[model samples]
Target: MSILGVDYGAKKIGIAKADPTGGPAVPLTTLIVANQKEGIERLQQLIASEGVELLVVGVPVSLSQSGAELLRDKDHLNKQMQEVLQFVERLKNTVTIPVELEDERLSTKLANGMQKELVKINGDDAVAAMVILQSYLDRKKL
Candidate 1:
């Protein structure tokens, strides 16, 4: 199905576009997901504009790491990012299309590390959307 991938965040929501053929997801513009109402309007506009049949949102899940360095998750960070998921959850009821959530632990980091022409987009909403969309694509592969 044609879909819009969203990197849900408090300040901004990253977005990506993909068709049902299972191809590379292209980065679209980012949305300023301000609050509950604003988030809904933006998402609705995006869905209509892109003719999206499905929506994929990123969920930030932090881990305790259990005495290991790898377990040290940015709890505060994810807590703040929780607003994104809240928006997505709320949208689940209002929208006609299906919504999917994927783990977005390292998408921001990946966005920050982009190089070359993408260097300008590093740490921006577009890169974040790429991470979200790519994760969705990878998951569907398995």
Candidate 2:
């Protein structure tokens, strides 16, 4: 089974793909967040091209407990997540794949560190999506 992972941002959505038969995940081109319609279209294209069996989305939760300020941010994230959830739901309809979220606390930072030794790095968003996907793979194994 192949899986598509996404790191959603306000401007750019990072993408990565991993197959159960393939050894490692590879980054795909970032998608500019147009409206939900365009976002779903872009993902459907990726799904068809990559043969995705599952979809994983990153959810940015806080590093610590919630407070008044944290609650405010939490509410904002919740609102934003609704958009993503809607996107995933729509994607699942077209792709007929399992769609879910992985706790994406600091996968972005970790992916950046992993790429630091490279000669050149492209979009961090796509790399971060790979990190999220790889983590899902590892946990699924356990």
Best by lDDT: 2
- Write candidate 2's Cα lDDT for 47-123 as tens digits: 88878778888766532322234334444567766565556556667666777777677878877777564313547
Give the total clashing residue pairs for model 2.
0
- The Cα error of candidate 2 at residue 140, in Å, is 0.3
- Tens-digit lDDT track of model 1 for 56-95: 7776663222312212332444555546655766888889
CA lDDT for candidate 2: 0.72
Q: Global lDDT of each model?
A: 0.71, 0.72
Say what the RMSD of model 1 is.
5.7
Q: After superposition, how far is residue 86 of candidate 1 from its true place, in Å?
A: 1.7
Ten contiguous residues minimizing lDDT sum, candidate 1: 63-72
RMSD of each: 5.7, 5.3
What clash pairs does model 1 have?
65-71
Model 2 earns a TM-score of 0.76
